[model samples]
Target: MIGKLNHVAIAVPDLEAACITYRDALGASLSQRQELPEHGVTVVFIDLGNTKVELLEPLGENSPIAQFLERNPTGGMHHICYEVPDIRSARDRLLAEGARVLGDGEPKIGAHGKPVLFLHPKDFCGTLVELEEV
Candidate 1:
């Protein structure tokens, strides 16, 4: 089962501009940009009091974010992550309930260094959902 809202991920065409918007205009504290080659993204976390905002920029041409950007050049909310106590169990339950998991249906290390899995957008009312173990 899902727990607290972990973070909302946004895909951006310009990582620096997005970081500046959150850091300077919004007065938010942000982490240094981290390249997650495994996930094919370069990310920066914007610290919000209760939750965080994840900014994602495609790391390579094959990156999923690149495809997303191709669909929406302006970029937008890519996914919403929710915390889970047990990722495997949560995945199993989702599978049994006929929900589709993205990728190989396995958990991968996320930006927070936590196990994370992405659910198919179509399965969650057209919004991609990410479950991160905490």
Candidate 2:
């Protein structure tokens, strides 16, 4: 039901700075930066060869990223995204297996403009797992 890891999303206070830090300090390269107004956050993608890292910055106080940062100020891993061939089928299987779906009975436009859905963290051993069809 799951394919290769698409990327690891991490919450951060500053997107550009994080990109620079990861670039020079950790040798990660900035692949793209996109603002997701609907989600009230901006995401910067840092390429790491086969995998990628997504840096998320809240655009507003009420944004979920803000709440995430409040819980872990020194922002860290936010979620794990897995590339799925068919989101609906994958979601159905997960639901049949008792995993809680965050989406409301339908997939939504997600980062990279792809259909995406999230499986509740509690269902995945406290790790937020996102399934995306690219």
Candidate 3:
């Protein structure tokens, strides 16, 4: 049902600061910043050898990341994404297993421009799970 770990997402109060920390402190290479308006986030991806880390900042007041930051002003891990060969098929299987999909239970275009779905945290040991079609 899950493939490789795609990326780990962290909500940050300041995206640039987070980028600087990863770049200067960790000496990590980063991808260009991207604004995902539909998802209401500004993101930067830090590439590691086998996986990636995503830093997210709220793009607007209504952004979910903003709400997350409200609860955690310092920001923290928001979700972890996993690759799936077939998103819809994976979604269906998760559904059959009684896992609740977030939103409309339909896949949405994610930060990687791939079909992605989020599962309820309560169903996944209090960790928000994101499935991205590889």
Better lDDT candidate (2, 3):
3
For each candidate, the alpha-carbon lDDT, in order, equals 0.92, 0.87, 0.92
Q: lDDT at 3 for candidate 3?
A: 92
lDDT of 1 by residue, 24-134 (tens): 898999999999888899999888989989999999759978989999888899999999999999999999999999889989888778999999999999999999999
Q: What local lDDT does model 2 show for residue 131?
A: 89
Q: Which stretches of candidate 3 lie over 4 Å from their true place?
A: none
* Ranking of models by TM-score: 3, 1, 2
TM-score for each candidate, following the candidate numbering: 0.93, 0.93, 0.95
Candidate 2 per-residue lDDT, tens place, 3-34, comes to 99999999998888888899889887787788
Top candidate, metric TM-score = 3
TM-score of 2: 0.93
lDDT of 3 by residue, 38-128 (tens): 8899999888989999999999659977777989999999999999999999989999999999999989988778999999999999999
TM-score quality measure for candidate 1 = 0.93
Q: After superposition, how far is residue 103 of candidate 2 from its true place, in Å?
A: 3.3
Better model by lDDT: candidate 1 vs candidate 2: 1
